[model samples]
Target: MSLFFKIPFDKKQIELAIESLELQTSAELRVYIERKKKNQHFSAFEQGLDYFNQLEMFKTEAKNGVLIYIAYKDQQCAIIGDQGIHQYVTEQFWQQQNRLMIDYFKQKKYNEGLINIIANISKELARYFPYQENDKNELDNEVIIK
Candidate 1:
């Protein structure tokens, strides 16, 4: 069953945001939305971890993949960073990003929330993994909806 009474963000808005963010850095960011997993007991973080692998986020040349997983029906979400990015950022940084998203989510501003998070992540990525001459986009910019 579709859970959202009002769509969080239009598909083009998300895609353009992601594409714009990606242009500034080498880090790969992907958003995945699932409507309540069949295993309803799984936590948002766990599901995100599984999707990180299932989505082949680890296959990047620099291992710098980030996943923003949202279970719309359950109103739960997790932001996951791959090993390359995690090594440079602290746990607190991730918490801050998560908190930022949650704050906007509370106000029903999913689009702004995502754009803020993406911009922040792009800043950090640029600092740690600036784009190189040969750096190609390793992941798709589209938001995955299921």
Candidate 2:
């Protein structure tokens, strides 16, 4: 319990990264960190999906929301995209990101690794969901630590 009391990035940094990313895309992004698995029976992705719905990430107008979920004590991570964005990108896209994170994680570069991953995801989201003049910030950019 409480293994990740001190995470790599702060609220300001995460908000800034998300703000910069949102300026270019209509998609929403969120990061959730927790001390341990709430349900040991669930895989990281399933746990993420549960939060995705609980957080109403599926309610975005364009159905474009991404959640990066991490459980530190459990040593698990899952990045999930809602249906709208998922259909456009292939499964391999997600796998590549997971691999990218694994490399950075092994090097203990959590902040840098997450920022890079955010930037990469931003590019894809912007490509497919470029910001519209009337686009609203559908979700809060704040990183969630639970």
- Model 1 has how many clashing residue pairs? 0
| 3-84 per-residue lDDT for model 1 (tens digits) | 6555676778888877877777788899997667646777788889999999999999888999998776676778899999
**Residue 104's lDDT in candidate 1:** 83
Model 2 sits at a Cα RMSD from the real structure of: 2.3
| TM-score of predicted structure 2 | 0.91
Candidate 2 local distance difference test against the native: 0.84
